[model samples]
Target: MAAAPRGASAADFETAATHAIILDHRSGRVLFRKNPDEPIPTASMSKIMTVYMLLEQLKAGTLTEDDTFVVSEKAWKKGGSKMFVEVGKQVRVGDLLRGIIVQSGNDASIVVAEGLAGSEEAFAERMNEKAQELGLDNTTLRNATGWPDPEHRMSVRDLARLASLTISNFPDYYGLYAEKKFTYHDIEQSNRNPVLYSFDGADGLKTGHTEEAGYGLVAAAERDGQRLIFVLAGMESARERATESVRFMQWAFRTFRNFKLFADGEEVETAEVWLGEKVRVPLVTAEPLALTLSPDMREQMRVEVVYDGPIPAPVKAGEPLAELVVTIPGVETVRQPLLAGSDVARLGPMGRIAAAVGHMIWSAE
Candidate 1:
């Protein structure tokens, strides 16, 4: 392992938000976390789940972008941010999505809920079911609009996981979050997520604010081929939320990186074989191996193969034979399975006798 750098270790990093988390999108590695699992009022951030439900329908072919839903008086009368949709008027699903994502419209969420599940209460039930299905154990949805309610809560980690699911499962629709503004009924509203405007490479996600939840954001960005998903909640103000989101995201990108150690099926080492037609069997990784670590840690990184013996008569190709162990300072050691690259047939009876005699003679030297 290399000497620890002097400036700032990942352990020393901190954030002001009451609940926060950062995750490596590709590997699902948690880069940073603070009170990540405690469910708290999520405000409009819960709308991410609302949008997710809509996206699922779209992906399943049950709904289309051209689909329209009537905006009920209930939706029109609901308070808070809105898409300024007219009551009793039919609105397109595409526009409603824009309304909810870019405008953070509580009304748009209600419209989606009613359009899909007939009522907000039913839609919330579906959301809870889906939450469990998706392994968001700490999330609970009370309403489609994420309207202030004591029961509407989600943890920062759950929010980040939801963000990851949305981006990976609905790439086509996820881009809508990057839109700077949305216009409906001649009313224009800029996206509430400030990171899109202030941070480079930031594309999509949701932001939230309420008296109880304070201010929060679910943000993601892609630089190079790697993407990061992060959540920040309970900030004092929107300005602080914006500042801290960008700052924490920048720190995360600057501190850690994904390093590809080996490609899929690439030979890692060779293991000796006893009484086999072939003297050695090639060892390879079944999948590409990558690790997230600080750039400076590369110099101290160590990789080695571990296997029990150089024995066995017949070996099947792709059979698990050894382990690839990786060690880096300040990071947990990673272990990957190494498999036999090709089949090694057992030696013939005569060949085994000759091989044993040769081995004995070679050992005498």
Candidate 2:
């Protein structure tokens, strides 16, 4: 594996972990990927999905923070990092979320699955459905608690997507991941993600470990306005994996800079139009587009505009006018649609005459 920059180094990582993934949460640009598509055991990282499904229930009003769930004898018997919930005790939905998130409590996770979906198997179905909705094509669900399930699988790239969607779509509820500790039945249990304390800008995320899965972490960190998410899986040791994650994130932030590709409603330059009152309609990116740039190469970068340009002027408000093509040296070209900012009416007689004259003058030039 390549070495990380000075502050964050994989050198400290003794593990020969094969896969890693990184993404910029703010720009939605992938910064780095190693063995990205290969399916691997998600280990305890599966809990992230478990939490996501639970949040879905809460949002749909099927569950509420104030609702209390009684821990069954079966739930308390669950073995893993735990919030120490005893059998027959009632725990709030909110408390269980914190326990599962911060403490990585298997008991809380199972209770949540059972409470929300009638059974853990039923909850796994929900997990798979949510993964599909998020475009996590490489992911499969087996357990609701991130417990060992050979059939349970996901890839580093897909895990990053899950983290991104979790953070992006559910900001109000995702805060449970940031809590350092959770208390239940008077027992205070701490979070397992080491990066939360060891790395700067490191915040809410989940960590996993098992004899078969080794050590894994799905973490998100923010420095300045840029937020980053990554998944580190199949490591030999816990400490090494944590160090490597921080190293990877630090490298991503220092190595790339954000560039604004387009702004909302800005005239994306003009495009040729025909038969409408107007000869050309302005093209714009449907939304604010952004990209990551290498510090040295940004100054030399350029954007190329293309497409049918003004098209026909009878275009509706959302009529596609042109394609704003972006060309960055040594990178893939990205094209965003340039739309008519507003409705351009069909040509009036004067409008047609004006267009004809304008076309003739342009042809002469």
Q: Which candidate is the best by TM-score?
A: 1
How high is each candidate's TM-score?
0.92, 0.85
Report lDDT (CA) for all predictions: 0.87, 0.76
Q: Could you tell me the lDDT of residue 3 within candidate 1?
A: 17
> Candidate 1 regions off by >4 Å?
1-11, 296-300, 356-365
Query: lDDT of model 2 at residue 49?
Result: 89
Question: On residues 89-146, what C-alpha lDDT tens digit does candidate 2 reach at each position?
Answer: 8889998889888888888888888887878898898888988888888888887877
Clashing pairs in 2: 271-310, 272-310, 273-310, 284-338
Off by over 4 Å in 2: 1-16, 273-281, 296-300, 314-318, 341-365
- Which candidate number maximizes lDDT? 1
